[model samples]
Target: MFDKLKEKLGGFKKVLGGAIEEKEQEAIKAGHVKPEVSIKKEAPESAKPSETVKAPEKAGIFDKLKAAVLEQEFIIEEKSVKDHLWELEMALLESDVALPVAEKIVEAVKAELVGTRRKIGSDTGNIVETALRQAILKVISVDSFDFDGFVKKSNKPVSIVFVGVNGTGKTTTIAKMAERFKEQGYSVVIAAGDTFRAGAIEQIERHADALGIKLIKHQEGADPAAVVYDAIQFAKAKHKDIVLADTAGRMHTNINLMDQLKKVCRVNDPDLIIFVDEAVAGNDAVERAKLFNSAVAFNGSILTKQDADAKGGAAISIAYTTGKPVLFLGVGQSYKDLIKFDPNWLLDRLFE
Candidate 1:
């Protein structure tokens, strides 16, 4: 996962490491910093017998030399940081990162590296990796929502509506959520509110049957708002722990469809509205998320096809673009493949 982004970061590390090493050599030559081997002794053959005294050299000299080398500080110049960041910015853009997001990461990294102090002989790889990871982490750590905590503390029969453009796996994500909720000891009722698309009702029905959860749906051309309302009622009557409503996929430009979605929200007043999109869609996904947020004001997002996403720009940009947390990531096709979003989890994959 995120192989392309990872590769680009690795390239930057190598570039920075080479530049630092060159600077170190130049500093040594110019007498700005002393090299570790500066304290040299005469060869054995050239040493006088008396000077070469019988006793071995005291350990104090060696200790002091080691301490001096460890205490030596190497400064990374600001110009060097700026020079190397252009390549990284281009690489990020090539990986489908938004221009603003790429610029943010680059500036963060530059702040971390420019004029930074490091001990001489420190691992250059570690230095570069730390800067890059922190930069990426800062870009991704937007306002977060704790899905588990919310479900635990909210009133019983938590109602959630899923929305997104078509072919983004919005329906499957609902089933995944239902399975997850059931595993956590919560009864789930699914509302097949996607009444516009052909086979939409049957698709959700198959998932509900397989998961052994009750599903409430209407005919193909019925009003979706009615279906969601009925599902909420069914959950209340049966004392179910949650209601997962699936809405028909519609582009943000489709004014009529968006109005229909608003009606569903108005009537049901769900506890949360989750936006769904594919991670591989890149900048397109980010833009869609922004437009959708403007349309419906969703609470959070769930990114699907995460496993197949090599660029990983969508996952990084969506939360920042929408100002909403990414609650979950669909890593695979299985119901169990959905993982809660975490900054460290993504950093580990990029830097591992």
Candidate 2:
């Protein structure tokens, strides 16, 4: 998928290999290691200047080096296909796949296709494509929450609670979730459980009004658990299909606030606990995930601000570290910007 990035990285392999060989030769010549010889094909006449000249072709050194490296012949059962797979691996690593993770993906790809016999006229590209898909599947671990599964298994009044530290988009994500559920003809209600913030209740109310959904809120500085208890009871009485509760965004280190969140969970008994986080927060997002998981026992994750996060490391790392399935990714501020988690699509976008 990330063909351009792969192509760029592929050009560096030969240069790096040559540098390693030169260093080894220097070590052997200096009596630091035993001399070892490996056969290397000679460069073509066109690649090696026949006679030393003051000025040759005006191509840059990188272009000359690439030409010299390409002159040597190497036997691969499927040269083109192998090259393409190698490029994919490089692109994955460049896109924040840790070294160990990248190595595991490469190993999986090799095991799946490298030694397999194929028909003489068959397209090796197809085999490589299969291997790449399998490799991505292995790294991403797609056995998690399924939206279709949820639709079938969940009963009406599915209660979902949003939990996270402050500034992680918890309140906005609740609005987006409400919008999504409402579009599906499901009656959705939002509970402004974030009673600590002065404007939090009004903010959620504003979204509820805009979406034409019911909102349950309390006065500022009221107990969060009490707010959620009232919301759940209200939703139950009204026969609402879903209840999205937004919790106060407090630091995980605040023991008192963490206990308060636990109380909210205890009171609501939500069907799902989604931990909202900012994708651009990087490693800090991972830390917050850990804290929220400990505080309210989160079931899954929702990453926000992905459109602005170039590194995208938080999504992968948070999922892996927390063992929590990522439920949705917020690409923009619009309601439609929230995307359901698709492992294959995510990998394609990340590497691309």
Candidate 3:
């Protein structure tokens, strides 16, 4: 899924390894080590016949010298580490990582490189690998959450509002969440709050029927917040555990639509407002997430079509841009495609 991003990071690793190797070679060539000459002294030029000179005992002197010579005895500072990191930073940007996130990663690598201790004339690949892993972990783990734990601990009728631009699979993502909650032994209800779209109600109705979950709706052009309120009431009356509300998809720049979302937030006071978007949308998705967060302050996100997104940068950038964790990823069209986002799992996918 993240093939492109993995390739990009691999490139960075190659550059970093090369830079460290070059610096180590430079240190070795600068004669920053003890020579391999023997410990025994030459015979005296005069009076060799009359004076008897004691020869020093060879008590592991050669072993000690070998260890000293082979040891990374020299320390060389590579000032050009910045240059390599700069290339990495550009590569990250090209992969659709946000500018701020990319810069932070580069700075982190730089900090780990400059004036750091290393064995002279030895391969520094492991060192560079560690630094790169740490940098990426820092960038993506800045904001994270435990979704299943949170859902389990939350009060009954745990409401989750789905928000995003049109055609980003908002309603389907809600249906997937409904299935997930149901699988967890929770009674689920779906609120078809997207009244602006012509076929939104029918679309959600199909999912509701298939999942055997109750669907709450009003009509086309009806108030989305009112639909959510009614859904909450129905969940409460029927002892349902969760309410997955689907809001109308609107562009971030639409003032009227954004205001409508604000009203929904004010009215329903949902537990978790999740932003849904396409994984392949790249920077557009990131900008949309930022704008949506600014408008209604979403809790996290669910990215759809992750299987098709080779670069897979939106998954990283969206969290960093909005100061929120990615709750889940929609890998395919099936209900089982909804995979929870785990930072460690993602790290292994990229680094291993």
Q: Pick the candidate with the highest lDDT.
A: 1
Instruction: List TM-score per model, in order.
Output: 0.88, 0.69, 0.85
Q: Rank the candidates by TM-score, best first.
A: 1, 3, 2
Best TM-score goes to which candidate?
A: 1
Better-scoring candidate (lDDT), 1 or 2 = 1
Instruction: Please write out the lDDT profile of model 2 over residues 213-265, one tens digit for every residue.
Output: 88888889998888778887888899888888898998989899898888888
Query: lDDT scores for all predictions?
Result: 0.83, 0.67, 0.78
Report the error of model 1 at residue 95, Å.
Answer: 0.9
For residues 50-142, write the lDDT of model 3, one tens digit per residue.
232122233421111111122333222344465567778888888888898888888887787665545554456677777877887787775
Least lDDT summed over 10 consecutive residues: which range in candidate 3?
61-70
Q: Which stretches of candidate 2 lie over 4 Å from their true place?
A: 1-133, 350-352
Against the true structure, candidate 2 reaches a TM-score of: 0.69
What does candidate 3 score on TM? 0.85
In model 1, the runs with Cα more than 4 Å from the true position are: 25-71
Segments of candidate 3 deviating more than 4 angstroms: 22-78, 120-123
